[model samples]
Target: MSKNNTKSEGAEEEQPKGKTCFVIMPISDAEGYEPGHFKRVYEYIIKPACTKAGFTPVRADDIKKTNVIVIDILQRLLNSDMAICDLSSRNPNVLYELGVRQAFDMPVSFIKDEVTERIFDIQGFRDIPYNSSLRIDEVNKAVEDISENLKETFKSKGDDINSVIELLGITKAKLPDKVEISAETDLILKSINALSSRLSSLETKNVSFAAPKVVTNAANDISITFNAVDSVGQVVKVSDRVKHFKKGMGTVASIVSVGREIIVSIEFDSGDTGKYTNPVASVIKVINSDN
Candidate 1:
């Protein structure tokens, strides 16, 4: 072929042309798994399977960064041509997204690590279980299994085999008609902005009130002590007592700093725990500080 024609053909080959498979799975490390474990699973196993099955795999994180991440996720869950849901860690987000896919009577392939127990609601559905050890030979076999499953699942899309709607004898959920940004949405945005402004003002006021004051000790030496809310307003240190708007009273069990944001993990009094990012300052009130 001529140079230009050959170049054109190569360019076309590089571009993916097939149905998109949305992979609903844990993007972060689970409590029991090593860090980046799931990442490796996706890279080594799921991605190859999707390609072999003539699909372009799209994960939640693969979507182009957008201001409205939840909206983008919901759109993909509702409208993707097919999906693969990993139930390994029983991650709430993963289950929720899978539920959305099932409710719409969409075609999906289910997979999980051998160690994880199947969810009660979905016990009847067939899921391809793979060894998490990721031995080379085992991984190769899993890739084949998943690729074959994807092809079979897509071919039988009209049967709705794993659909919860079909099992419940209820009408399948339909995607909502796309609508322009409405006045109600605009009002909600304005309200959020107002609340953010108020929080900023409160933080500033708190810093002023919590400013350190010099003191003379009994031995006549200078000393400095900090009051609560001095370092970061409404940001609790480890072991601090806090009350969440929904999760109730909790003790700050751990705090991790990621980039410029702080991730706070709280152990609730009700035996539940949660992790929140920096904006958690708005959702929680510090009842007591370690200081």
Candidate 2:
């Protein structure tokens, strides 16, 4: 190759590809708290610091549709650069989503409402505390600290992945040859990553996840969510099988989250009713809720 070609190849190799970041937060908690706390903190404290540090903040509240929100949010969690989870108020949904993120082994930072107990058995994950009475400078200082910590985490992870790949004597060029469908799917993921990077660059911040694309043919929407822990002692692919329902004529497909556990939603068209006879899929996955 020519010198320019070699330089181009090196530049491409140095570029981190196939990743995005999803911020998982609880808009509500077990205490019936709404989105006020997060809104105030994000708008007043966290967001400006994120912008200053060049990080994109993706929150679940920014999503319009519930179904799309779930898909996009989860996808970003699984595939993104890093995840920031606010554990304030001990929200079940936040905890559940955090579990999913942990299962996928993504880099996540937890924040809490200062008074919430760390009762959950999620060991190792620590929460950053913020007092409501703190001055703006104090809050900004905390955010900057957290941002630095996250950046360090990303650096460490990169080193770790490189070490693992080297130990296994694996190279990106040696990855399994993806089939046509898989290639298309990879393209879809790559597009998301590229767009994510572009948006981050344009915003001069870290890219946050947008809502996911929900595919449904129903006049009135019905959503069923399937979430499972990777408890089967074996790696499971959420997209391993297409879940089908009787009389619905549609299949539930898992869009595997790259770094997190897989979650797939199955939506039935209006007026479609039939017994779902699929053999409970598998024990590796759980239905967090089918509503």
Candidate 3:
């Protein structure tokens, strides 16, 4: 290949939707006692610092809530260029997420209030320590420190492995062939939400629910969700086996996310590909309620 071709290949390799920094932390509802404490940490410290470090900071709040919270978190954890996890209070969910991120060779930084007990397992790992009192000066200093941490992390390109994958000498981590789905799904998700809202509004206004006449009657929507995991624990591709689709073998030709829910298009050997205005239960498993 020519030098220009090599340069273009490298450019294309970069994740095209800018960088995403997944923020994993305890939410107020999860830990009843810490009302407003965690929120302040993100607002005054983490988010600002991560944003300054040239990342679009995202958290669970970015994805609309649904029963598929785990799926949403896992997807973000897998796809983000970097991660900032708050170990404050040592919340179980936060720690679980931190463990998941550790398995990947991605940029990950930890944050914690100085008051929280030292997590013995990750004692050697670097973290941006903040004061529990959250005083402005202390917070500012923490931000500066975290910025330096981020700089070092980016410089290292997350090559320093810190998880079981590294310790066990596991060489083949199952990462996706492409991570471009996140950017496209963002638009698809927005469209789904818009349509959902309009449908809800019509129901409130006493309009009868109606399927459009132009609908393709033969096809249905199927989503390959977290439940559809293969033996290595990777999500099973719904599009991989269209021959036995109804017998629970298929793959997603396309997919869209609405809130915490994902809808996928699947085609069968019989030549039917289902598309729908709203996602529904699949042959593999039923979707959890939005509640």
How do the predictions measure up, each by TM-score? 0.60, 0.45, 0.53
lDDT, candidate 1, 266-287, per-residue tens: 8999999898765334467788
Q: How close is candidate 2 to the true structure, as a TM-score?
A: 0.45
Best by TM-score: 1
Q: Which run of 10 residues does model 2 get worst, by summed lDDT?
A: 227-236
Structure candidate 2, residue pairs in collision = 20-80, 20-81, 54-205, 54-206, 55-206, 56-206, 72-212, 78-259, 104-260, 228-286
List per-candidate RMSD values in Å: 14.9, 21.1, 20.8
**Candidate 3 wrong stretches, greater than 4 Å:** 1-17, 29-34, 65-67, 176-291
State in Å the error of residue 4, model 1: 51
Residue lDDT tens for model 2, 71-144: 66776666567777777676778877776766545566666666667754653345567665446777877777
lDDT (10s digit) by residue, model 3, range 40-103: 8889898888877777889987788542456688988888888888888889988888877876
| 2 against 3, candidate with superior TM-score | 3
lDDT of 3: 0.63
User: Sort by lDDT, best first: what order?
Assistant: 1, 3, 2
